[model samples]
Target: MNRINAHNLACPIDGALLVCHDKQLRCEHGHSFDIARQGYVNLLPVQHKRSRQPGDSKEMVAARARFLNSGLYEPLASRLARITSALVPENRKTSLMDAGCGEGYYSDTVFKYLEDRGASSGLSFIGLDISKPAILEAAKRNRQITWLVGTNRQPPVTPASIDIILCVFGFQSFEGFRHILKPGGRLVLVEPGPDHLKELREVIYSEVKKSRPQDLTPVMETGFSLVDEQSFQYKTGEISKHIIADLLLMTPHFYRTNKAGREAAAHLEVLDLTVDIVFRTLEFQNP
Candidate 1:
């Protein structure tokens, strides 16, 4: 197996090949970025930023780290590992990128699972997120994986160089993904199913509304054809108050629910949560 590192990164400003120097990445025409001591780089340029601080906040990331580390979502992580590992190109160096990987929980688990299954020899991993705090926490998960603070609109990677990209409940542009994924590359998206967290929503919202399935038409229009999709659902029979709190803090519902809704959730001593998620694999239809 060839040892191909995750050096297929590009300058966020000028899109030139980034060569690593001592604790820094430098591209031709003098674009440079310093790698943080925690083993990640800030590839997001200020000009491309929508705000001074973007994506998940520090508190949110901390909550996510706590919740994910609890192994409550181990089933989902296992499914992700199985899907991604099977997509690894036979006997060739494969590059996997987790776009919008928050704190790298899923990516780290999947990467390690692949490694333990003997795929690490020819696999390179990159975890990118717009949130600095999220990427900072992600960097601590695995030093071998390249973690970068970046966004989906302008991913700091070489065009047409990636083999697989995993976007888990993240906002993204399939058209932009087309530029980074090579011909026949696989793009896996994990989305929340309609019944996901229904129990929690029932308690928080005044009236629970069913969620619609993600539309695939727009994604197909972006030159991606759906390959396969699978759904996973399970119930956590009984979870404690703190565990529920951690779950809430890690999700968008933390902000979406108002004070009364939050108070309703907090008052519950025990809760049963149904975890429903979908994993969809799409192939880029190169012209």
Candidate 2:
């Protein structure tokens, strides 16, 4: 029998209760969503869609996959796995939803870790991204997990159904997240620390601006209380010029970097990339 983690879901269309049963999730108004053969459920409603395709492009997805597979961010993934594992209940089935799950690198890694510990049967992993190409690539690489082309603003699950919600280096919709997570359900958010990618910033611009890390207070204000927090740092080895260019294009820094900056990065010898990864675990609180 396939046991889906359905506690963190809600009807995407009307914000009503969603019943996940017998491989189908049905809302009170007779709207039904089928669970894909590959084990993922698509909760994106047509009205919420603004574009034919969304989120990261194929180029960005490929570049991210390459960079991640190069082991540049293994430590970050490991840290996330450890934290997520600790949150699972001992006997009950668990479900994890990765919002903006780009290319499935982090989701696949974490799911594998849990599965290796005999937690596979009790856990279901869902990777949701707005980009159809990203969802396609993720589904191709990790067939065991569910991948959906959807947005964080309108996740396709039932309200208060998920046990864990993960947002890694992607946009977050706190209200949407709060609505989907069960009471006491945990939200694991990974964001770039202040010093993240300092090397790349240095090479791309004459002066690097030291921006403050994201303020979680706003999220807290939306009814999430911080339960735990941690930070990890590591250095990634040299990358090819072409890969480096792709990395720049896939990141927010690309827009900030000027033409001269791009030319400078294009001719760099090697980049000593540094990653400052911050992890925060939050629990839903009453609004």
lDDT of 1 by residue, 1-287 (tens): 11115879999999999998877889998999998888888999999899999999999999899988988889999999999989996789998999999999988999999989889888889999999999989988887788889998888999999999999988676766898999999999999898998999999999888775579987787789999999899997888898889889988898999999999999989888899998999999675
Best of the candidates, TM-score: 1
Superposed Cα deviation of residue 13, candidate 2 (Å): 3.1
Off by over 4 Å in 1: 1-4
RMSD of 1: 2.3
Number of the top candidate by lDDT?
Answer: 1
Against the true structure, candidate 2 has what lDDT? 0.80
Clashing pairs in 1: none
lDDT of each: 0.89, 0.80
- Candidate 1 to truth, TM: 0.97
The residue-level lDDT of candidate 1 at 36 comes to: 82
